[model samples]
Target chain A: AQSVTQPDIHITVSEGASLELRCNYSYGATPYLFWYVQSPGQGLQLLLKYFSGDTLVQGIKGFEAEFKRSQSSFNLRKPSVHWSDAAEYFCAVHLTGATNKLIFGTGTLLAVQP
Target chain B: DVKVTQSSRYLVKRTGEKVFLECVQDMDHENMFWYRQDPGLGLRLIYFSYDVKMKEKGDIPEGYSVSREKKERFSLILESASTNQTSMYLCASSQDSSYNSPLHFGNGTRLTVT
Candidate 1:
């Protein structure tokens, strides 16, 4: 079975400041990792995905994440976060095979201050 | 862009009532999934359908059943509404069976059972 853990329950960041959200996973093989963002009263949107090739993957809305095999982590980062970036972020993992079910972590709520 | 649509944005049901949640996707994707989101628990998969009339149980499928009579529509049914089952219901769809494919989600339905 695959599982993901997001340590931080909530994080606050000032606008135009760098932001980082940590995520860790436990899987036997290389996992398909994804970052999703959900605004208040809205559905989740895919921010980015990491499969195999690149360790550093860029995503929409000026977000990026690094897939670290040694740490079993895929942490999301943004150089300068905007006020609109305040949302709940989730890290998900999928097995490296035909199964498409995704196991998600306890989301981290991000609050941006101007 | 893929568009997944859930029928309701909010619903209030009484205990022991039969609840129905409907979802539809415009991308004609082969896979559709139903998930429930709670405060400390991210998104727990209730059920998923790989194809029309082919439904599979997910991690929390004990109280939920699903119907996928057509390719683009999937319906989740709750036999008896419970207070504990009150949560945000999310619907998602993926392009294919590939593990790397990302999911497109609907705006979610917040259900309250009283």
Candidate 2:
């Protein structure tokens, strides 16, 4: 069984400030990790994913996440957040051979201040 | 671009009503999934279909059923709607069950049970 944990439930950041959303996962083998963003009244959009590659992966909207095996984390980061970045973000993990069953974290609500 | 469409954006139903949530994928993906998103619980997989007419239970499948009669269509059914089951339902599709493929999601259907 695989599971994901997001330490922060809510985070507030001012516009032009750097932001980071923490995510950790527990899986037996090399896991497929993904970040998704959901704005108000909308479905989730894929931010980025890490299968097997460079630890630092870039995604849409100038977001990036680093897969740290030693820390068991894949935290999403942005150099500077915009007011439109206010949304709920989720981190998910999937085992190698599973039928695309993703184990998702509780999610972190990001509030960007103007 | 891959597009997954959910039939309803908002639904109101009474208890004991049978609710059908429809999903369709424009891409010729072989795997489709249904999930429910609740506050404090990011997303829980309700069911997934790997191929036409083949459905598999996900992490949270109790009180929910699904139908995959065709390759492009997948339906999530609530046998008896309950208040606790009221949540935002999301539909997703991926190219295949392979680990490398990412998922595309629909806008979601917010169901309210009263």
Candidate 3:
């Protein structure tokens, strides 16, 4: 079965520091990877996605993710963390089949400290 | 911009009662999905519809049913609500099943079954 794993359950980073969130996936085929962020009491917003193009994908709010095929990982990175960046981040893999569903990882919650 | 709207922000229901959760998408998307968000379980798909009057079971569809009578609306039904069903239900839509198409999510409905 295909699965996604986010090892870090919670992380606290000082404001203005760099941030990196780890994500790993297991799938048979070339995976379509995505990263989404959810704020408290709000819906999730797309952060970035990795398709068939370059290994590095850029997303909204100054976020980027690198898809490493050998490692089967897609890690999200931001140069500088802002206070507003405190949220839950989820990594997902799109499965192509009869249903074409997405499998998500247990999210990583980021708490930015001032 | 695509907009996915969930009918309720919060709901409380009694056990064994039938429950209905409504979702509407303004973009006339070809795919609509229902998922439950829980602590430590990022998001688990309940049901998804690819077209009008068509539905498919997802990863976790044991206690849920879905209806997609129209192109813009999809409804999730819980035949017998239970305390275990208390969760944050999210509705999402996508233009198509393309590998790159991103999902647009609605502000979730927090359902609490007592």
Candidate 4:
């Protein structure tokens, strides 16, 4: 079984400041990691995904995440966050070659201050 | 861009009522899924369909059922609407299986059971 854990329940950052959200996972084999963002009263949108090859993956909205195998972590980061970037971010893990079910973390709510 | 459409943005139902939530995907995706989002719980999968008429139980499938008569359409059914089922229901679809492909989600339906 695969599971995900997000230590931070909520985080507040100033607009144009650097942002980082931590995520950790526990899976048996190589994992497919993904970051998704959901705005208020909206569905989730894919931010980025990591399968193999590059450890550092760039996503839309100037968001990026790095997959650390040793740390079992895939953390999302943004150099400069905008006010519109305030949303709930989720970290999920999928087992390669298994059922397409994704185990998601508790999520981290980001609040941007102007 | 992939477009996943959900039938309703909000719904209110009484306890013991039969509730139906419909979802459709324009990308002809083979996989469709239903998930509920709560405050602490990010997204809990209720049911998933890999193909037409092929439904699989997800982590929380106790009071929920699903139907997939066509490749691009999936429906989630609440046999008996309860207050606990009141949450944001998200519908998602992927080209192949969700495990390997990034999922596209609908705006979501907020169901309020009283």
Best by lDDT: 3
Q: lDDT (0-100) at residue A105 of candidate 1?
A: 98
lDDT (tens digit, per residue) of candidate 1 on A45-103? 99999988979999999999999999999999999999999999999998666458899
Which portions of model 4 show Cα errors greater than 4 Å?
A: none
**B1-114: candidate 4 lDDT, tens digit per residue:** 999999999999999999999999999888899999998998999999988999999989999999998898999999999999999999999888646588889999999999
lDDT of 4 at A85: 99
Clash pairs detected, candidate 2? none
Please, what are the lDDT tens digits per residue for candidate 2 over residues A1-114? 578999999999999999999999999899899999999988889999998869999999999999999999999999999999999999999867789778899999999888
State in Å the error of residue B27, model 1.
Answer: 1.1
Candidate 4's error at A19, in angstroms? 0.5
Q: Write the per-residue lDDT of candidate 4 for residues A15-111, one digit (tens) a residue.
A: 9999999999999898899999999988899999999899999999999999999999999999999999999999999867655788889999999
The TM-score of chain B in candidate 2 is: 0.98
Most DockQ-accurate candidate? 2
Q: After superposition, how far is residue A81 of candidate 3 from its true place, in Å?
A: 0.3
> In each prediction, how many residue pairs overlap at the backbone (N, C-alpha, C within less than 3 A)?
0, 0, 0, 0
Worst 10 residues of 2 chain B by lDDT: B96-105
At residue A104, candidate 3 shows an lDDT of 93
Q: For candidate 1, give the lDDT.
A: 0.94
Could you estimate the TM-score for every candidate?
0.98, 0.98, 0.98, 0.97
Candidate 1 residue runs with Cα over 4 Å from true position:
none
TM-score of chain A of 4: 0.97
Pick the winner on DockQ between candidates 1 and 2.
2
Better DockQ candidate (1, 3): 1
Q: Which pairs clash inside model 4?
A: none
